[model samples]
Target: MNNLKREFDASTVAMMRQAMNEVVADRRFLICQSVTPLEVAEHILEQAASGERDLDRLKISVFEKLSDAA
Candidate 1:
């Protein structure tokens, strides 16, 4: 049970890291260094929490959030 939980946690972290990298690699996002990578990661996590696993949707949502912030 403990091993399963650990595995799940590790996978979740890896998924988030991949998502964050995708967000950072986006051309629109790259032009906005003021937003910070961590902030974009948080946005991605937030969308994931809401059951949004679609990568394109996550990217669009993150971009919308950044635009609103700007």
Candidate 2:
């Protein structure tokens, strides 16, 4: 599903929350000066927009984006 052009539904939202929670739980993700919850959420939405439906992948993508931003 190409969520890039559509509004995210409830399940997609739930997944993003779960993924964000997991990402923030990590100490490594917390110390990054450029990585904020809002930033992570935006990246999660970007991942979803790219058609990534897995929670793990969302978390991973957020991490990767953070790393790149660092």
Q: What is the TM-score of each candidate against the true structure?
A: 0.66, 0.79
Per-residue alpha-carbon lDDT of candidate 2 for residues 1-70, written as tens digits (9 for 90 to 100)? 2344568889988998899888988877977888788888778877788778899877878878878988
* Regions more than 4 Å wrong, model 2: 1-5
Q: Write the per-residue lDDT of candidate 1 for residues 1-70, one digit (tens) a residue.
A: 1122222255556666777888788887878767988888767776666666666677788888778767
Per-model clash counts, in order, read 0, 0
Q: Give the distance in Å from residue 27's predicted Cα in candidate 1 to where it truly belongs.
A: 2.1
* Clash-forming residue pairs, model 1: none
The regions of model 1 sitting more than 4 angstroms off are: 1-15
Worst 10 residues of 2 by lDDT: 1-10
How far in Å is the alpha carbon of 10 misplaced in model 2?
2.2
Give me the candidate number with maximum TM-score: 2
Question: Backbone clash tally for model 2?
Answer: 0
